[model samples]
Target: MNQLEQLKKYTKVVIDSGDIENITHYTPYDATTNPSLVLKAIQMKKYEYLLQKSINYAKKKGGLKNQIVTNATDKIIVSIGAEILKKIPGVVSSEVDSRLSFNTEKSIKKAKKLISLYEVEFGIDRSRILIKLASTWECIQAAKKLEQEGIHCNLTLLFSFAQARACAESKVFLISPFVGRISDWYSINYSSNKYRSSLDPGVQSVKKIYEYYKKHDYKTIIMGASFRNIKQVLSLSGCDCLTISPELLSILQAKNKLITKKLFIPKKIYAKPIKKLSHSEFLWLHNQDPMAVEKLSQGIRQFGTDQYLLEEIVTKNM
Candidate 1:
């Protein structure tokens, strides 16, 4: 069996892409998309139609300029997500506006609105979606409320164990701990050639979180995301889930090699519940971790900028 086939024996492969055409080849179990990816898709001629349809949708709504643009943006993302959902048997994750990442109330409202759009416009059920949110303290709280309403969540831009622990405590459905970004952080701040996949800081971060989750019997699925290479993917073979890009997915598909699992939850670790992170504790801990502080803020900025650029595209096309 090829690497992907062998890897699937232990982990579910989720395609992290906004381009629907490319996703069908892998037969991924689930799919994930973010503002940056959605922005990239809107520029492609093949996916441009989804953008146009969203503009038409916004115009039909006949709202004020700001509201229309916001409506169009959400519609376009769901437009792509709806298309992706049709192709994948599992759920498709779609993120809310990054600008609202910190506002718990707004985040909750946006999630509900997105869910409403999926149900009303696309006829997709809530179960078929994972409302992707940033791992902000407030956003997690928003998810706490959203989860109660039966809306599942996938927390993205996660860089630290604090984020993972909090998400697990909240009973979140899944948390995407970015492997590549954590590696990138170490590469910039503290580089070392000795860092192979086994020693890679990013790989170690996910491993730590995975072990903690298993030790505690946390219900949240640990989905490793933002892989820099196939080695990182191979290193995380036994993860609960791994959301991979098409580039690496194809590489795994082509490599006819056996993949040994690198991660295994300890057979015996005393299981105990973790206390939830309070607002002050969350702030100090989040600020305490230089990498998480940098990456989380950096990720939100990049996504927000991409979202604005996408809005620009919608206005220009209309």
Candidate 2:
């Protein structure tokens, strides 16, 4: 079997891309998309029709250019996600607005709106749509509300155990703990000597969350995302799911026979008993961890900027 097939025996492999052309080559079970990805896709010559169609639809809706652009961007994301579902048999995650991250009610409202847009406008089912939200306190709260309404969520930008624990506690659908971003932070601040062999801090973060979820029986699926290299990808081989970029997926596919399960069956816990943090503790951890703080804020801003740019394109065209 190819490494992709072998990896599937243990972990669910998800394609982290907006372009549908590459989906067949990697054949990931599921796929994920964000504003940035949508922006990238629409910029391509082949996808120009999608962008034009979105603008036409927006113009017909008879709204302001900004509104048209925002609507168009949302349509583009949903359209891409819907098309991706045609290729991959599993779910496709479409992210919510980063601007709504801190507002629980607004986040929930936007999530439902996105779902409605996908279903009524794009004709995609709710089951196949995992509403993506940042792993913030308000976003978690929003996800909890959405879950009760039978809306699934894919929590993104997750960095710490606290975030994972909170998401699991809320019974949210899935948590995407970013491995590459974590590695980036550690590599910038700390030395490589601090990590175990093949155990970068980012990989360790996902492993910690995986072990915790399994050990404690949290059904919230752990999907490792934002991998920097094949090594980081391989380190979480048996995770519930890993959303990998096409580049790394290709690398994994190339070395078909070399893949093996590295993370499976919860091992003996060696760390001291650490109580799941209260909201206060969670805040403390957030404040204490500069990397997490900076990255979380930066991630939100970046997504927000992409969203703004997407709106701009729509506005200009309309």
Candidate 3:
């Protein structure tokens, strides 16, 4: 078996791309797209049709220019996700606006509206979609409410154990602990050579979260995401899932290499008391983690910028 084939034995592979066409070739179980990817896709002639179609739909619905454009942008996300769902047999993680990342009420409202849009446009069931939210406290709270209402969520940009613990407590469907971003921070602030597969900061972080969740019998899925290299992907081999880019997936497909499962699925979880943090404690802990604090904010800002760029494209088309 090729590396991709071998890797699939221990973990579910999810394609992290907005190019729906690429997803068919990789045959990933799921496909994830964010604002940046959507923005890039908007410029591609292949996905250009999706942008205009959504814009026409939004304009026909009749709203103010800003409102119409915003609606169109959201519609495009759903349209692409819907098409992805057709190609991949599993869930399509469609993200909500990053601008609403910290707004609990607005995030919840937009998530629900996105769900409605998908059902109306493609008749895709809500059960098949994972609404992606930034792992802010507000977003986690929103996820709690949405989960209760049968809207499963995939928490993104997750960095710290505090976020992981809170998401587990909230019973989030999945938490994507970023591997590459964490490694990037370590490489810049510290040293790159210090972190490798066995000792990789990103690998260690996911291992910690996975062990914690397993030890506590938490059902929240752990998906190692944002991998910078194939090493990071293979490092967390036994994770519930890994969202990989098509480029790296192709790399794995070409290599007839061995995939040694670094992570063995934990059974007979360790006995320990799980601490539930108060709101203040959660805030303080989150603030204290330098990498988490910096990366989380930076990620939100970057996504927001990409979302703004996508809005521009939508507005001009409208």
Report every candidate's CA lDDT.
0.91, 0.85, 0.91
Q: Tell me model 3's lDDT, rounded to 2 decimals.
A: 0.91
Clashing pairs in 1: none
User: What's the TM-score of every candidate structure?
Assistant: 0.98, 0.93, 0.97
Give the worst 10-residue stretch by lDDT in candidate 1: 269-278
For each predicted model, how many residue pairs clash, with residues at least 3 apart or on different chains?
Answer: 0, 1, 0
Ranking by lDDT: 1, 3, 2
Question: What tens-digit string does per-residue lDDT give for candidate 3 at 1-318?
Answer: 999999999999999999988988988998898888888887999888898899899889987898898889989999989989999889999899988987999999999999999888889999999999999999999999999999999999999989998999889999999989998999999974657688888889999998888877889999999999988888889899999998899999999978888776577876676778777888898898999999999999999999988988887776
Give the local distance difference test score of model 1: 0.91
Supply the global lDDT for candidate 2: 0.85
Lowest summed lDDT window (length 10), candidate 3: 264-273
Q: Quickly count the clashes in candidate 3.
A: 0
RMSD of 2: 2.7
Candidate 1: tens digits of C-alpha lDDT, residues 38-109: 999989999877887888888899979988898999999899999999898999999988899989999999
Residue 209, candidate 2: C-alpha displacement in angstroms: 0.6
Off by over 4 Å in 3: 192-194, 270-273
